[model samples]
Target: MRRRISMLAGVAALGLTLAACGGGGETPAEDSNAQDASGNVGVFTWWADGSEKAGLDALVKVFGTDYPDVTFDNLAVAGGAGSQAKSVLAAQLKAGNPPDSFQAHAGAELQDYIDADQLEDLSSFYTDNDLTAQFPADLVDRLTVDGKIYSVPSNIHRANVVWANVEVLKKAGIDPEKPAEDLEGWFADMDKIKATGTIPLAVAGSWTQVQLFENILLASLGAEGYNGLWDGSTDWKGAEVTDAIKAYEKALSYTNTDRDSLSDWAPATQLVQDGAAAYNVMGDWAEAKFAQDGDKPGVDYVYFPTPGTEGVFDFLADSFTLPKGAPNPAGAKAWLTTIGSAEGQAAFNKVKGSIPANTTAKTDDFSEYQKSAIADFGQDTIVSSLAHGAAVPVAWLNDLSTAVSKFGGDKDIDTLQSSLGDIGEKFAK
Candidate 1:
């Protein structure tokens, strides 16, 4: 019960921005007429390739349909969770050339921008569009800071899904219908699959690897302990943290020998889809990749919460924020309107393989995988995603990513543990 309260407190903390921080430069005072707003609205994001692009295309189609005069500028820079793109975005924001609206994860990740005062309060925007009523109350709380909302979330994604190839599992004499109840059984199955002369697990570097670490932490430490890591309640140098790191090391062993060669997460998902690997633990967005290739769920593949996270929803969201000096405040507002609309949410999330942030968004036409995700999200113990910027701020995640990636290369559990402690000291203040 103590841990549960701590977890919720950490999540609630996302809604409170740094009070000490000041505002960004001069901004437009008037919001453009969303309906009558006619011009190019440059919405920048990190989804430039593969299935991610397809999801963006679906959203763009909706934007075009609703706002005919507003041209959607696809200013996407490809990187895992906007890794490479963020530095570029920072430069633009610093130079006062920020995009009209930009993609940001919907949790502590928004704190940096808010602290810099680069983001505009969307509270008015929400009231204007009835978005406050449309979005889940809990989600709205996370998106709000002080009394102001800074972004419009497009969709909620589960970060703890394991996508497996059905035929590959069958070939290894494993039942695709049954999900491994715990890591012991899951690793045993991976061992069996490894004996079949294939990569038992598929993974990529940087943020993807960090994501894998967080999932392992969730499995080894449970939701409370996992959430405790961010709040200093979980001892970074303790035996449990050590054990989770070792487990992460063991899991990395089953991954592809050429993981470094696999630059982006989709390629890792592709490995599973192509039957080169048996499983890929990734966000539900991987479902979008499989869907793009005409792969049917439960036939070509299957999804389950990452082993040991059966009833937990590892949550993250992709949202667009209106920058303070956005060249087109009207156009930014228009794009945000589409983002908050039930029709727009349905269109975007359907092709995106995620549940809409808007609770009232229709789901009758969604795929089986999406429906399952929606149901799980509705009933599960919700935890924030570290890799996707829900659990930690960007600086902390970036430093931790470095530690995790180096450990992936060196296999030094001690160094990794020490690095974690150093990071916790530096950031968990």
Candidate 2:
């Protein structure tokens, strides 16, 4: 039987309080000396492959230039979208062995760490560095909890994007420039590609399915309804959600049959890159992967927001936080400062296939796709990404992911709807 939503809330609150209180371990002293001490700094993340790793290496290169005395420890664990890293992080935090700093999604996702008091309040760091002026106001708001900032954002990624192979589209006799306007239209294009002996869509297992589902929900419900999913203004059990699920089911039907065997997003992206598949719905980071493989944007592939989400930026950010018990608090602060710096973010995002979170960062080095994302991020209705831990708590997202995985095998809309409604009631509050 499923746990009651209220029960989960109580447990979460207790966990947060215990986590915040140091969990019976020696936490770093809150003094200028501790904040300035330099030694080895361990930075944890799940950026162990492809363009993501390249991005991390670029940032590390910049850090090495600035802090030559400090040894940079790359504690990257292999996982798609930090799935494996998160589990390790949770265990470490519980054992009172937090890294010097670690990557996290901005927004409600960081709330857990904030609640646990496992994170140092970076409010002073932001004020000292003038980050309040550098980053966008909306993005800063997302990174804040109860008026206290916890993390410094490195880059912004758009989740609702469909990357297509231009050559594959040409082979299927479909116009690459004119993408479909809705689900039905997208299905028509997929049918044409399928007829040409090419896989119409490519998707990886589990987490990517959640990524695709969130975009489908955005396309089906539009910005207002999608925002309501997090804020309690929308009905999860309503007909609109059901319609979104139906659309997701149809979309999944067009995906690669061996999707379960594809362990990470990079392989599925490679399917589109190699032209075994025509399209892949993934975050803009896939752009970085293609670029790393020596593929040019317009000539090799094209990207657009998923159907019906053209004007909205489905947003998430890669951010780093200073853990409470970090062995090198000063070094962690220095690392985070570098992450928020203009030069550092530019170097990182240029390789990572994302836009710098700092609005003041120069974009001349950014690709056409990244430039467009930056412009849209500034002008569009911004919404948090569910799959990437921006819109919900870790536990809530885990529950949702479990339901999605079960639904993939069961194909039971009724069960999916029930599980979704229960999650909404529990987490959306």
RMSD of each candidate relative to the true structure: 4.9, 5.9
Off by over 4 Å in 2: 1-29, 33-37
Write one digit per residue (lDDT tens) for candidate 2, span 32-74.
3323546677777788887899999999999888777767877
Span of 10 residues, lowest total lDDT, candidate 1: 1-10
53-149, model 1: which lDDT tens digit per residue? 8889888998898888877777777786887777667766766667778887878877877788777777888898988788777777767678788
Top candidate (TM-score): 1
> Which pairs of residues collide in candidate 2?
19-116, 20-116, 20-117
Q: Cα lDDT of model 1 overall?
A: 0.82
Q: What's model 1's TM-score?
A: 0.93
TM-score of each: 0.93, 0.92
Candidate 2, residue 235: the lDDT equals: 93
